[model samples]
Target: MIITDTHTHLYSNEFDEDRNEMIQRAIDAGVSRFFIPAIDSAYTHSMYDLEKAYPNTIFLMMGLHPTHVKDNYLEELQHVETELSKRKFYAIGEIGIDLYWDKTHLPEQQDSFRKQIQLAKQYKLPIVIHCREAFDEIFEILEEEKSPDLFGIFHCFTGNYEQALQAISYNMKLGIGGVVTFKNGKIDQFLNQIDLKHIVLETDSPYLAPIPLRGKRNESSYILNVVDKLSEIYNLSNEEIASITTENSKVVFGI
Candidate 1:
């Protein structure tokens, strides 16, 4: 079975020590596709190098992450636009409102988010959102930018069924990750009610590790934990879960 980790930061310094081994481990575990999200202009070279090294495995997205939005965000957005204009990107993402860390930059975050969404529309690419503690703000912007062409994944979605439906209304696929495997994750309870088509698998690795390995650093290979949990929750076989979610990922990333 082939599993797709639609969102992962393989280029992060977190993987610097054994990046090759970790990637091999993921391959051994049947995760063949890795979609890398951009943090800002700073990580672009690393991300591109990774794609070059693993040409068949890695796909790249371009965007300035919400947390990265700062006083000089306009310059960062210019960098994002320049890169996008220079080459092709799988998507425009990991961009959205994030108020959890600091609310001081909320307005800049909102502006960056809207600008990136416009960039995605201009390029005809889907967006991969990174929302935290700002659902109302994010949804408000999405509502304003709502159009036939504006659609993407709600990355690391851990909201309620109502939120799930609302995200779907915006034409986004819910990106299920390590949180689904947590005992108190809550999403597992209503996941079965959501169609498999509306869901895609991800690990958000070196971050939200799944149970049996929760509280530890996560890797792409650990995506198996998420697949196993999803199988149980959806009452389907692991292979089925992998295949369906992989296909759903393809539909979103156009891979």
Candidate 2:
């Protein structure tokens, strides 16, 4: 069962003491590929270091996260452009409107999201979104920028069935993660309605740990927990769920 954690922050300081061991735990649990998303210029080196440490399994995305769209956003976006010009990246992401953090930067967040989507199209790369309490805001920009070239994952998707359909219409796959196991994580109620082709598994580690580990620090190894939950949601075996979702991730990340 080759599970793919399409969105994770393995480079995060959360695992500083046992990063390799933590990653190995995931590997042992059959979670192999990890797609790391960029937050801003600040974590660039750490991300690169992680790539070097796990060249065979780690893929990176470059972008300015919406929460980071502060006063220095223009400069940050410039950094994203510069990095893209220098080398290859799997996607431009973890970018989108995040009203949950602060509403003051809504305008800047929307602009950054649109500009980065253009960048993704320029490079013919996928995008990984990080939306929170801004579905309508994010959808507005996606609507204006909708095109064959505009496509990616709706990371940590926690919307209704209609919103799921709306995101799919825009060529996006819904990123499922720890939330699928929550008692109140509503996505599970209708997730079966969306085909496995439009679904990809993720851990979003150091955050959103599923089930028994809920509210605790999450790691890639816990992706098995997600797989376990997916099996129930999709009415398939764990290996089958892994196979389907991993293949779905390939469709999005082009891995």
- On the 0 to 100 scale, the lDDT of residue 244 in model 1 is 95
Model 2 clash pairs are none
Cα lDDT of candidate 2 equals 0.93
Which digits, one per residue and each the tens of the lDDT, describe model 1 over residues 1-255? 999999999987889999999999999999999999999889999999999999999999999999999999999999999999899899998899998889999999999999999999999999999999989998999999999999899999988999999999999999999999898999999999999999999999889999999998899999999999988988999999999999998888888
Off by over 4 Å in 2: none
Provide the TM-score for each candidate, comma-separated.
0.99, 0.99
lDDT of 2 by residue, 69-94 (tens): 99999999999999999998998989
lDDT of each: 0.94, 0.93
**Candidate 1 least-lDDT 10 residues:** 246-255
Q: Give each model's clash number.
A: 0, 0
TM-score of model 1 vs. true structure:
0.99
